[model samples]
Every structure is written in C-alpha cells, then in structure tokens.
Target: MDTRIRRGRRALVNWLERLHRLAPAKSVVWVPAGTFALILVLWIGTISRIQAEGREARQAAAGATSQVASSFAAHIDKTVHDADVAVRWIKYEYERSPSTFRLDTYKEKGLISAGTALQVTIVGPDGEVLQTTTPEAQPVNVSDRRHFLAHKSSPDIGLYISRPVLGRVSHHWTLQFTRRLNNPDGSFAGVVVVSEDPDFLTTGFNNLEALGVGGMLVVMSDNGYLLSRLASGEHASPVGPPASAYREMVDAKGEGFTDPVDRVPRIVTYRHSTQYPVAVLAGISEKVALAGYRHARDLYILMAGLLTVVLLAAAAIITATMTRLVAARARMQHLAETDALTGLPNRYLLTEILRRRIGRERPLDRLALLFVDLDNFKRINDALGHQTGDELLQNVARRLVRVAGNKSFVARVGGDEFVLVVEGMDVAVAARDMARSIIDTFELAFGLRGNSYVMRVSIGVAVYTAESETEYDLLRQADLAMYAAKEEGRSANASRYHTFAPDLAVRGMRDIERQQELQYAIQNNEFFLEYQPIVSLDTGDTLGVEALVRWRHPEKGIVLPGEFIPFAESTGFIIPIGELILEAACAQFSEWMESDPRPLYLSVNVSAAQLVHGDLIGVIRQCLERHSIDPRRLKLEITETAILKDAALIARRLKELRLLGVRVVLDDFGTGYSSLAHLTNLMVDGVKIDRSFTRGVPGDRTALAMFQSIVSLTHDLGLSLVVEGVETEQQVNWLRRFGHIEVQGFYFCRPVAPGSLQAGRAA
Candidate 1:
C-alpha cells in the first residue's frame, strides 16, 4: 500500500510539471512561440464563434419582438377602422332625417327595433335635453365636455364617441356615440346620441392564447381610465394603465409601445388613436412569448458547446503533431472591459482608466468629470419598446464619444446614465462646452418610424482640483454636482467648492425652516394681525388697513411679511397662512367696529391656490359669521397671475365672492401677463400699481409715465387706483400729481405691529 501511494504522488507531481511547461512564456524564440500563437488563434476563433451566435440570438429576439408588435398594431388599426366605418354610417343616417332620427323615434321603435342598443337621447346646442327614449334617465349636461362640443361644431358633423361611461338610462356599461344635426342651410342644430354595449367592442379580444398561458387584454382612455378587459381571474377588477406605463404613453401621441410590466414579465402594447384620442392597450405574458425561444436558445447553446468541443478536439490533433498552443488572456481582458448591450466601455473600465490617469506623472492635472443622466429615460424604454431603447442608448453612446473627441473618456455607467471624464488644463471651459454640446445633441428632432421623439439630458459636472487625490473623492463630487443638475431640471448644472457658501447653501434650508416655522406659528397662535391703515385721499378718514403677515419668531423677534412671505407662497403653506390672517383681521375689525362704529374695511391678500379653491366663498361666509362682521366690510386682494390663470374659474369664484358682498381687488396689476385685459374682464374694486413702478417712479420719467397712464386708465374704467411702496415725501408728492393718493409704503409705516400701527397712521 505504501509503495502504491508513493508511485501515485510521483505521477501527480510529473503531471503538474507538464502543465507548467505548457504555461505562457514571452522568452520562447520559435517552438513554444509558434505553439502559443496557434493556441491564441484557436481561442480567438472560438470567441468569434460564440459572439456570432450571441448576435444571432439577439437578432432573433429582436425580430420576434418586432413581429409581435406589428401584429398587435395591425389588429388595433383594423378594429378602429371598422368601428369608424360603423360610426360614419350611423351619422349619415341621422343627418339624412333629423326629425325622424330624434330620441322620440327611438322611443317609439322600442327595444325590439334597437335590439342590444341601449337608451337613446337627443340634446340641444346648450346641452339641455330635447328628448330621451327613457323618462327615468338622469339628466346629463354634455356642454361642459370639449369632445361633445368639437363634434357639434365640425363641418362634417361626424359621429363622436366618448370614452366609456356608465349608462344612466340602461344602467349598463356603454360608450356614448353622438351625431350632430344641422339645419338645411348648414346651421347648428340638436344632437342625436346612442349608447353601445361594451361587449360589442371587446368580443374579438376576449379569447387569445399567449404562449399557452392565460393573459389579459385591456382597453383604456388616453389618460389611463380602464374601459374594458378580457381577463376574469384576480385581474377581474377593472384597471387603468399602470402608473409608470401611463406616464410614458400619455405623451406618446399616435405611437405604439411595448414595455414590460412592473416586476411581472409581460409585454404591454399601447396605441393612441389619431381620430378619437383614446388609447388601446393589450398585454401578453412575456414568460409565455419567449418559452419556445428560450428552449431553442438553450438547445443552440448546447450545440455551441458541442461544436466548441469538436473544434478543440481538431485543434488538439493538429497541435499535438505541430507542438503548438494558444493564449487568449489579452482578448479576454478586452471583453471584460466592454459592454455587451452597447460597444462602449463599461463602468469597470471607466474606473480603471480614471485610476490610471490619476496615477500618471501629471497627477495633479485639472480634469472635469461629468455625470450624464438621460431625462425620463424610463419613458423611452417604456414607450418605444426595450429593443428601441437599447438602440437609442447605443446611438447616444456613439454621439457622446464623437462629441468628447479623443481628449475625454466616456463609459456607460448603468442604464441610461454615462460618465465622461475630460482631462484638460482648463477644466471649467471643457466642462461647460461638453455640457452645452450634450444638451444640444437632444434638441434636434429624432425620427423613428415616421414619428419624432425629442429627448433631453441633464449633466452634472465636477472639476477636480489638485486637492482631489483619491478616486472616491472625485466621484463623490461628480455625483453631488449631478444631483444639483437634476434639481435645475437636468439641462446643465455644476457644483463647486465655492458653491457651498453660507448664504447660497442655506437659502433653501432657511426657506424650508421658515415655512415650518410659519405653519407652527399658525397652529400655536404665535401669529397676530397687523393692519396698515389705508386712509382716504379725499376725506382724511382711515378707510382700512391692509392686513399684513407678521411672524413673531421666538429668538429672532418680530419678522416682517417681506421676510417670510415669499417662502410661504412657494411652499403652498400660504393657503392656510393667508386664511389665518383673513380670519384674524376680520375678527379684529369686528371688535374695532363695535367700539368706534366707523365704516371700516380690512383688505387681505389671496394667493393663486387660494383663489382657485372651490370653497373660497364658503370660507369668506364662515369667517364673516364667526366674527359677526358684515361681508361688505371685508376686501379680498388677488394678484394679476391669480386672475389671469384660468380666468373663467377665477371670474366665477370672484363673482360668487362679490355676490356674498366681499369686495375683490386685482393687486400687483402690471406685473403679470395682460394685466389690463384681466382687470377689464374681472369685476375688481381697485387696481394697485406693482411696487416695481412705484419704487422707481419718483426719479425716472418712464416709470412715472407708466404709473400715470395706469392711474388714468384705472380712473377712466371707474376703478380706484392705489400706489404701493410709497417711501419718501417725493414719491408721495409725485404720486399725488398723478391723482393716486391711497398708498401703502415705508413712508406710512414699515408693516408695524398692531400695537404700534395707530402711532403711524397715515391720515
């Protein structure tokens, strides 16, 4: 047994020595050198074969995806076309006989004639009902909807189908299709509408076998409201498009998309109609579509392995006779550093390059490192299909390489993000140029399949100084700069050491703190009403004081409205803050009126969000009743933007408030777009010149002329004019010449506390 063990050890040692002799060596002149060369050739050939097979597999996968997408789109296109034809026919019938095609005709014909057709209704131009097939149906006003009005005004008066709505008459799921009736001379007339059952549209999609598994097919609106579906399992409940998918698809007009469902391996195909503006979505489980492909791929892989073995066997025979070997260490290294999806360098290569560059003779060279992040990349991936997304990313990589020239290093970090390292003596200039070029690259129209896709990139650049010695520090700075770029809407933003100055860095933090403090001030009763007495220019009696926001900071003492007012407006904290001030001012006026019995009004500023609030009138009514104050004594001040944005909504809100006896004044009149137009349209009690013209009016003739013209126009329109930011006697005198006397400014009082306000009364 001992002799056998010793013999076995000797045999193992001899085998290891032979393997070592086969190992690569650069010193060999011909024999072993030729062997190594041959070995390398064989290895390269094997790699080439593997790469070819991989490319073929990718091509097959991409082709299958394209085929499925095309098939689904063709099916949807045909379905929509057929539906359009049916709708056009019905519209033609209606236009041919307007009176006979009315709702009364449908009622007389009854359910037998209509068959599965739901209740029919006819409506006039004003959205008022002309007639209905069923008397029990609830009244529906169609004028508020844009789609209904569009068809009614169209020259062809084509049939218009709304997204699915629950039927009021039949109480069944239906889509309402309407056709417009025109007078003999092409004048406007009433509309004839018919309800169609959802089953009619969903029948074709109800039964589809995808990869031999149960899959769902859904139809939805452009905004992602579910219309119909063909699944009955856990997905029985109606569902809209997924949030991620919906966001991606809504902006993709007249385009078809295929993307994977969240976590679940499924393909979602969505297309929006150019005619109806609705989206149709269909999905099949991806696990099922690729089942056969996966099996074939696996078989191919096995065959490839066998082929590799056969080649190796053939090589071994030739090599044994010729004493040749091969080495593929360098080729393997190159493959490891490259990206398979895009032929660009991977993150690993980026790091390696960065390390080497930093360790060179000129270690302290100024370099700019940029983090390029594709904005809304997920949208591309979701809307254009992953194959398209992959193609786009490759194109983007090539563009970056071209734009960077030979002076920079560009690599795909992960997903749609790429890192670019620019080595230059002037880091800042290089960084700015690269960022501008990258941003401009996506500005041009990108055409794909007759559809154009516009994309944008957010770039963050960090310039490495001599202080940045380590890779981690340099990368960290780049990342921080990238975040800054994202905050700036991702076009181009850089971060520098000096950018962290005390004032710049703390502004946002301070604003956030102020917002929180103001909210707390409201809740803890730390805020109090401070009224600036507004005296009448003619009578010398105090008209009212504009209620100003004042925060009584615990440590910082009293802070004026100017300090925290902007912070409040930005954070939407102003809504509640403004309400608190309104309630407090009204209550104070109620108390003051009871003692003096003088006619006094309190003016409070209202934000855009507050003006748009549906309950503004209700809140005003509540505050008046709570304070036992008359509504006429309270005035609401609104900025120009507030009234101009959705003028109809603001007009309605203001009209309601006016009806409740609360006066509405358009404040900061000239600062927003079309201020004069808004002032004329809205029933405003007064117009206040914005502080910009007021503060500069005293010396500048142009400012004075603009201010005078505004005053003249306000008076000509029978609206009172008030000057804001009246500071020195010169400003007040100059304003008086323009017949503008009612003013608020530092000359009257610097928004003082209520206790000290009486001492600084203007009158």
Candidate 2:
C-alpha cells in the first residue's frame, strides 16, 4: 500500500511539472495551499468580527424598543386621565344646575375642553328628556343605552365608559362617559353623560416619536371593545388591536410587552385608565422599532462583505500577477507568432514556415500560396461600425481555416488578407478547391446583431516554382493576383479570383494610374456631356435626347464610361461627376428649349452614389431654377441597381421628384440585380430597355416576344418605352410594331456634341 501511494505521488509530481513550466517541481505543492489558508483565515476573522458587532447592536436595539414602548403607553394613560377628569367635571356641572345644564358655563369655568369632549348631555328620570352641548339637538331618550341603564340600575356604578358608537347629535364615533344622578330620596332620577372624541384623544399620540411610522396607539374596553386606534402614518391596522392584545395589554398595566399584534410582531406597552373602564395601548412595530439596530447590523455586515471583497480582489490581483509571471515567456512567444485578432498564424510565423520548408523540403513538395482579400469589406466596416468589421474578419478567418483544413497552413497576413500555404504535387488543385470553398462559404449570409450581410472574397493563387526568387516574392505575386481578382469583380457584383501571371502586375499598375488620373480629371474638368436623340422607331421622329457623360483624357483621348464609372462609384467620385453632368445638362437643355421648342425632352442618368449621398431633388430644383426650364421636359434616369440596395431611400426621393413634376425614368431596365417589384413600386415616367436585350432581336423569337411584352406592360402602366442598341433598319421596322416605342442607339445617331445636336436640328 505504501509503494502504491508513492507511485501516485510520483504521478502527481510529474503532472504538475508538465503543466506548470515556470514553478519548480518541489515548491508547486505548498504555494497554492498557503494562499488558500490565508484567504480562509481572512474570511473567518472578518465574519467573526461582524457577528460580534451585530450582537451588540441587537442588545442595544432591544433595550431601546422596550424604552420607547413604555414611554408611548404612559402618554396614552395621561391623555385618557385628562379626558376622565373632564367628564367628571361635566357630571359635577349637571348636578349643580340640573334644570339649566349648559356645557358653555363649564367650558368658561375651564372644567371641560371642547377638543376632547364631543358632547355633554343630561337625561331626566323617566329617560324622556335630554339636554346636550351640541347644536340642533332634538330630545333623545337614553332608555336603552348601556351606559345610561348601567348608571340607572346600579346607582354606584361611578363613571361608566360605554362602547364606541356614532353619536346621534355629535355625528362622530364617540365613547360616552355616563354617571348616575340621584334625587334626595336616593332613587335614580337621571344620568349625566359626557362624550369623548376617541380620534381626538389619539391624535396627539400619533405625532409622538415612540409611535412612529407603522406604529399605533389603541383605546380598548377592558372586555375587548376597541374605541379607537391611531396607525395612519404607519402601515398597521386601526380597526382594533390583535386578539392576543387583551392578554398582554390588560395584564401589562404601565409596563410594555413584545408580541405580534394583528399578525405583526410589535413591542407594545399598555396601561388601564385609573378613572375609566378603558385601556390605552401603545405599540411600536417590531420592524420599525428595530430600524436603528438593524441599520447598524447591516452596516457591520456590509463592512464585513467589503472586507471579504477586498480580500478576494487582493487575492485575484496576486494570483493574476503570479499567473502572468509564470506564463509571460509563452504568451510573448505566442503574440509574436500569432495574429491576435483571429488567432491565425501572422506574417512572421508564415515567413518562418516558408523558410524552413524551402530549405528542408523534398523537390516534389510543390507549394501554392493563396492570398484572399474580402471585397467591399472596408465599405461595410465604415458603414456598419468597426465591431461588425471585426466580426466579419473573424468569420472570414474561420471560414479560411475550415476550407484550408489541416494540411494547409492558413495565416491571417493582415486586414482582410490571409495566406494559405499548401503542399503536394497537385497543390494548385487543392488551392483552387480551398478558394472555391471560401467563396461558397461567403455566399451564405452572415447574421449579426439582427442584420444579415453577404461578403465576397477575391482570391489570388500562386504556385511555387524553381524560378521563384524567395517566399516573399511568392506572397507578393499572390497579392498581385488577388488585386486582379478584385479588378475582375469591379465589373460584376459577384466574387471573382485569378492566378498569378507575368503581365498581371503591369495591369495592376495601370489600373492604379487610371484611378489617380480619374481623380485629376474630376478636378481639371476634362469631362463633357453628349446628347443622343431618342427617335420613334415608327416615324424616325426625334422625341427626346439622352445626355451621356464622356471623359476626354489628354493622352488616352475620349474614354468610355464603362472604363471609369465603376471606379468612380466605388470611390464615391460618381456623386460629384453626376452633379457636374446634371448641372451642365440642365443648363444646356434649358437653352435648347428656348431656341427650338420641338417637343424635346432631355434624360440624364443618375448614379447610385448621387441618389444616396447627394440631394438629387435639391440639385435638380436648383438647376431648373437657374435654367428657367419646364420640369416636365427634364428627366432624371436612374438605373434599377439602386433600388435593390437602398429601395426605401430611393423610393422616397423619387416620390419627391414626381411631386416636383420632373419626369423620372428607370434606365437599364433588365440588367440590374434588382426585382420587377422595384419597377412597380417606383414612380417613374419611362423605362429604357438596356442594349443587351436588343442584341438578340429581329430574328430571335424569344427576344421579340420579350420586347413586345415589355412594350405592352410599359404602356399599360402609363410609362413610355424606349428600345436601345438598334443598328439595323429591319430591327427598327420590326420594333415599330410596338406602337410609339422610342428607339435610341448607334443606329439612329451616336452620342453627339451639343453643337452637333443643334446643327442636326437645323438640317
């Protein structure tokens, strides 16, 4: 058994040595035990001290409660004695002047108080006639009254206190004090009565400190009839004292007792009125009476609790310090090699892995590095907040890890860029599979904080070769390939990817220069607008002209919008470009309207950037005011793309435009990643079928049928239609079948300069 115990001890020691690398093997066992022992001692000592102080406070509270209860009972007894004396004086007054019994004379003589005595009355021998101090009193026979009958039957019944009742004349709950009146022959002739307002008697006691909030003073008959009680400021009852009250109160006399009254335990003091058959009960609610001592006890408890918290906080600080001291080197190493945000291998570790693999790996250990870049991540970060950006990056890292699996070394290089290194003769295929998995993962929406977001990843793939300069060159090539994928995505909304090549880097440089030149072009006003006339396919009559934006670079000559518009939109430069175009078109069209009122309307395209950021309505109104043009002749053409992204905002702005009488058109009718519901919902004046749909026209039955359907729907919905990209006469003649549908493309006339447009009108 002792050998087995030795083996167990050895096993524990080995386990501790393996787990705790910093601590020496011998001392690991005692350090934690010492800390625990110290904490336990502190806790026990703190509790002991608090309990001692609590006991002292309790004793003081009990003594104080007894003192307060005793004082309140004394006050009640004194009040009742005073009222008894007043009643006795009234009895004396009635005896002195039997025929003319008046409380006014007694009140003047200072023998009675109006505040305490509610009424004073006298009844004749046959209980037939009465006189009272109250005003407007009729004669009331007291033949059946207990107080009166008690006096009349037993001539020596002294000052008799009756049960509480509503006085007929006084009209308040009163306790009647009755005394017998005898003729000279010793026969009972009448009864003299004094009524006391029980509420008035208890009013002064209510204000006393002993009977504070939730305390009460009660006046009760010896037999348990409750005359009155005061518990207004307190939450206790005033209907009567509790059932057990009579035993404690009647027996207590001037002393107080601690007992529950009305199910609420209280420290009660009571006394019987010496001159009357009544008892005065004064009580302090046990809950309220112990408030002072309870507060002290609570303070002690709180102090002990604070001490315990302080002890715990100190222990935690020390423990944390010790833990960090033990793990400092390991944590420092981890931070140096790992990405802190997503816990992936950072650039430093990736470099190390590449260096080791290149130096030691076999010739057939081919490698591929995938550089993943999330598209539009920065826009989402800026718009939603950094928290969402962080969650997105973390989620992106997780997806890369999952797709890269165990064989690939997936490392987060930095901000939305991750490098995946894979090995095998077929590593390129593996890299492609990983990239596809990442793209597929991004297709599924990410739900966060009650919002769903779709993220797209642009991956650049580079395979290892003997010609490669170094591992850094591989990452750089991967980076260039990633940018190429992003460039490919610029033309479409979906995610795109590319493999590294020699010429890709050169194109990337050109794209960079182009972006720079685009910004410069905006500042230098190298942009101009051309108007393309929209002619009716049926008669070749010009209905309206669509304003098209063109940029004239000095070296590159005229550049089309498809080359720079996406970049402008991406960088938010489209807003300013759209503004410049609208301002110029509105000015030029207003001039054309004055010279030639040939039923011409001008359409200007509105970008998503302009609709969301710039105030389209305000700019158009300003343009109309400056040009003095009829708003009906001006059209703001917005593509269907903006509807799916910001439908609510665009819909509201378009409704405002419709109200302003500016004709609106939904441009690029079928190409947008939008729904038909958007077309129905928007308040537009016209729809321009995009040029792509027109390419399959004239002979393609599907194309003709679709156009015919669109024409019918457009006319039914009260919107005019325009067919674009019509280059042949046969296509135009066939399209003419749809009545009054406007056609605009290179077929009718290419986008011409404003001067050329005026010249064509002259011809």
Candidate 3:
C-alpha cells in the first residue's frame, strides 16, 4: 500500500511538471473558468427557484380571486331573487283588484323597501305612469323602456330585467325589474317596474381587503352589458365596450389577462349566476400579488453575486500560491537529486540513472560499472580536518570526471566512494582499461593546504550481462571487486585495480547470506551469553565477570563468537546483538545478586558500531533500571578503536556513565595507538591486558616485561587492571607477582552459562 501511494504521488508530480513545462500561465487559467461555471450554476438555480415561487404566487392569487368571485356571484343571485319576489307580489295585487292596488299602501306596510329599489311604479297598458312610490307623482310616459315593451308584447314574460337606463319618472340611472300585469282573460294589462340603482349591487358585495389594491368586483349581464362595477374601493361607470369573451364564456374559470378598464395585468376569475342573467368577476393585480416573491428573488440574486465575488478572489489567491509552490518544488527536487558538496549526482539519482540505462529497449553491446573507493580516506579525514578531506574529495571528483571524459557518467555515492557508468564500450577489455586508467590517474598526489599528499584509489570493474543482472546486482558485484582490490593491495606485489570475477560473486553471495543469517539470529533470539569470571589475583576470589555473546545457529550447532562477531560488527548487526547481550547479562547478574550476597560487577563489551551509531548510554541506563541493578555493579567494556572514531563524543558519553555510577573500562588495552593518552583523557575505570600479551607470560620474557609495565602503569595511575588470556597455573602464578591484578582466562574458569558459574569461584 505504501509503495502504491508513493507511485501515485510520483505520477502526479510528473504530470504537474509536464504541465508547467508546456504552459505555466495556462495551468492557472482553469481556476477562473471553474469559478465562472460555479456562478452560472448558482444563477440558474436561483432564477429557477424564483420562477417557481412566482408561479405559486400566481396560483394562490387566482384561487383567491376565484373564491371571491364565487361569493360575489352568490350574493348577487340572492339579491335578484328577492327583488323578483317583491315584483311578483306587486303584480299579483294589481291584477287581483286594480281599484285596491296602491304603491303607497305597500310602502306603508314595509313590504317595499328602499334598500332593494329606488322607486316602484305601475304603468298602465297605454305606457303611461299611473301610480308611483317617488315624491314626483307627475304623469310620465314609460312605454319606450325595454322592460315595459317586453312585458306588454308577451304574457309569457314572467320577470324582465332591463339594462341601466334613465328612469322617466325618477330621472336617475337604474336597472328595472318588471313583471307583466295580466287580466282574468289571460292578456297583458300593464307593467310593474322596480327601479334599482346599479351601484347598490357592487357596494353591497365589495371586499376591498381581500381584493387588495387595483382589485375589482364586477356584475355583468349575460349579453355582456355591465350592470355594476367597483374597482380600487370606488364605484365605476361602465364606459368601455362589453367584453365579447365574457358573453361567450359559460363555465366559471380563472385566468391572467390585462384588464380593459385599467390596462393592468391581473389574475381574474368569472362566476356566472345559475338563476339570474348576470355574472361576477373578481380580479387581483399581478404586481401586488407577486410583491413578496420579487423581494425574495432580488435578495437571493444579491447574496449569490456577493458569494461569487468572494469565491473568485479566494480562487485567485490559491492559484497564485500554488503556482509559486510548484516552481519552488522543482528547484528543491533538483537540489535533492544532486550532492551538495561534490556538485554531482547523488546516490538516489545514480540509482535512477542506472535503472533507466539498464532498462532501455535497446541493449548495449558492452556496459561496465566502476566502483571507486579511496584507500584509507577515513584515516586521512581524521588525521587532517574534515574540511581538508572534503576539498581533497572534490579534487578527486574533478580528476575522475576528467578520466571518464564526457562519454561516461560519474556520481558520488558516499563519503569516499564514487560510481561510474561506462556505456557503448565495444569489448570487456575496454571496461578493464577504463578502470586501470582511473586507478592510474588517482596515483598522483592531491594538493591541499600547500601539502602534496599521495592519494590512492581502488577501482573495481563489473561488466553487465544481458537479461542476467539488475542495477543492484551490478553495484554489489562492483563493490565486492573493489574490496578484493583493496585486499590485494595489502601484498607486496599488488594490483590497485581488479575486474569482477565469478569468485567475487560467490564471496558477495556468501556475505549477503551471512548478513541475512545474522539478522535472523538477532530477530529469533538465537544468540546467548556466557560469562567469564574476572578473578582477583590478591584474594583469588571472583570479583566480576565479562559477558560474551555466542550464536546458537540452528544448523551449525553452537557457533562461537570468532565466526560471527566480526561479521556482525561489519554488517551493523552488532548493535541489536549487543543490546541483547547487555539485557541478558544485566538480568542474570541481578538474579545472582538476589540469590547470593556477592557484590560482583557485570562487564558487557561495547562494539564500535554501537558506540558510534547506536544509543549506547540510553540502552545501558534502561538495562540498569530494568534489572534494578546498581549502576556501579555494571561495567561497560569498550575497545580503543571505538573511542578513536569520535574521542570527544565517547569521552562525554563515558563521563555521563560515570555520573550514573557505572564503570567504563578499556578492553584489549595495549593493541591501540596512544593507549596511555586514552587512559588519562578518557577517564577509564580499568584496563584489560590483551590475551596476546598474556599468552607468552612467564615463558616469553619480552611479553612478561610488557605485561609488567602495563600493570605498573595502571597501579601508578590508581586504575584497576584485569589480565586476559590467562591459561595455565604458570601464567596465573606469574600474574600474581603483579599485586592486585585481576585475571580472566581458562586458568580460573572458561566462559559458561549462568547455571554453571559458581558464586565463590577463586583461582
């Protein structure tokens, strides 16, 4: 999963790089385009919503107007029915007894109300007014009225309603409701007319609050003649031509249209009376009906516009920042792939180049990789300052580049190692010749700080085979050949360069296998410890023990330290193996202290790799704390080589250990250079004599003298001394001459398991 994620990220970076290379400005243009698209979508959605709300508002308005129209129609029908009943009573009384019938009599009895009509009159068959309810009882001719003419012409006309006209007797505009007066012979006699004011019908049914501003309530005849109309809280006289569509319309329905009277867009509904020849129209203006919808729609558009502006600004800022970041990342990637000091391709880039070259579609006839390593570069670096070493390495890089020319690629892969890829070579001999040329060129001394120092480099040449080797395999092979060259250079008749042979491949494979085995051994807990007693020569009593790690290989039975310790050290497996040893030794010593009252200290060897790379001090502190052992009871044994790597750092670590009350001793004392200086400067608690010096003690006088001198030096310095490689009683007896010297060898006890060691063993 991690590999897949890394590949995906790399692919994305590559794509971006290509885009930037093609058109940098065009890459950010999409931000504005995307913003515009988003705004368009917002506007489309908002407008659609506004339109939908407007439709709903219109529907609601239409429904309200329709309801108002229905109510108005019902009221008008009732009023007309009541008026017809009064007219029939008047007609019946007149027809029954012309002598007794009188308009004043009906008015006195309260049967004829002024609310229903303006005046009531009886017209004789000659079309002249005979009796009237109005104060003007003057004689008048009413034969020309449509109501009177219709009733006089036909006896079948029950009740006739006339359009608004000027009353002959009252001299006012009124709608006449008339019934025929018939004699006992079934012939028309005269007309009974009820004069009603047209404005009364509209005023009686007006609902200004429900209709709103610019609303209308109108009653019209079936012939399209307007009877009564009220608009915007005011009575209106019918002036325009009758609406022909209203006359043709039979069903009660609602619609939106422009009103002819006011020229206003309105939602209008029409309801026709079932019994009467009249219809009611209720209308509401569109502007008033959709006022709220318009407000909300405007608000939505404003908010959307503001949001679009903010989003576009943010997108612009983000695009600018991303553009700058992309440019910075390209520069950083170049710097990362190149070495800082040498200004050459680093290991990471070297691997990629090698992979690409090896994975090409067309294979080269002969390809070679040269692994170059400086001889004793670390010694030169340590003897002189690192700055000088760096300058020297740079000079070497220039020289190697010169030797390789332009055809080959050279890269610095490590502090003192460089790799060169030679392609297009015709034969294997050419590759070897190139390696020889590199070695021969480096034979000259490098000039630094006005000093001419001869620097030798070992070169290893590995030729590529088709379909058989990978980039890693080539590197490994070249490295192995380089080590072989260094080994050969140790002899008198030595060659400074070597080509990779099949034997070197075998050796490399063995090394790889050994490293794997060591790793497996550490992981599986296959390594165990055996403690060797450090006996006090004065009292012949066990004072302390040194812990030695041995690997119990599953296949090789019991593997001794001599076989795998150096391998483990070189491969960095020693750190974990050393940790295991320290933990086991501390635990075992704690157990011993618990069972027995002996105040014996435990000494665990510290490897060079552990001192330099691993967190030695923290590991020791944890071990001491975990086992609940006194710091003084735990001694760490370090070789002079470990201190030589970084003396100041090691000294400081040793001082911290002393502060913890832990003792630090130099193991194999006499073998390293400046031993006495280390003893004084490093503040060591004790020093152990190398086994070589003790092997010849009492037999070889030179060895005895050296051993005695070391002992006297420790005693004089107020430092403890332990002699290693004590074999027979003769050596132990000889070591007794050196008073207060401790011996650890087979003479006292061989290294054994925790169960085998006796508590009070004395030599």
TM-scores for all candidates? 0.39, 0.45, 0.55
Candidate 3 residue lDDT tens string, 1-763: 2333234335434533433432343466677778788889988998899899988888898888888888888889988898888788888889989989888888898878787579999999989998999985789988887778888888786778777887888888888888998888977788999888988787777555788888887788865677877777777664444645345333535577776767677788888889977888888877888788889888988998898888888888977886887678767866887677777667887776667666653245467888999886876787688999998887877777777665565778999998877777574677788888886786677887888877777788887875667788888888988999888885433438788889998888899999988888888999998988999988988999889988899899899988988888878888988889988999888889898888888998888788777988899889888989999988888998668767776777788889989998999898887877887888789998889888887889898788778888889999988888988988877777777788898878889998999778565
Number of residue pairs clashing in candidate 2, backbone atoms closer than 3 angstroms, sequence gap of 3 or more or interchain? 2
* lDDT by residue for model 1 (1-763), tens: 2333234324423433433423354432454455556656755765676667655654554454334434544555565565555445545656687667654554465521344345466667777666666656677676755445876668574656665666555666676766776667777666666666654555554235431353444555554455555442223232334334445544332233444333344444555555554555444555555556566656666766676566667655765544433335445654777677766667776666566556543345476678887766666676678988887787777677767765565778889888877765777777778888877777765665568777666676666566546665566566555655666773242221111122332554665677778778878877776777776555446667788877788889988777777767767777787778777888777777777667777889888777765356767888899988888888888988667555666787888888888888888889886877876778888887788998787788898788778888888888877777777778766666655357877776666566665622364
Model 2, stretches more than 4 Å misplaced? 1-369, 374-393, 402-456, 463-476, 483-497, 536-542, 562-573, 597-599, 612-622, 625-631, 641-661, 671-678, 691-700, 726-738, 745-749, 759-763
Q: lDDT for model 3, please.
A: 0.80
List runs of model 3 lying over 4 Å from the truth.
1-337, 347-365, 374-393, 424-430, 440-456, 486-496
For all candidates in order, the CA lDDT equals 0.64, 0.73, 0.80
- The candidate maximizing TM-score is 3
Q: Rank the candidates by TM-score, best first.
A: 3, 2, 1
lDDT of 2 by residue, 595-713 (tens): 88587888888887787788888898999899888889888888887666666777788889989999889988887664356568778888989887798887788877777777778
Worst 10 residues of 1 by lDDT: 493-502
Model 3 CA RMSD to the hidden true structure, in angstroms: 11.7
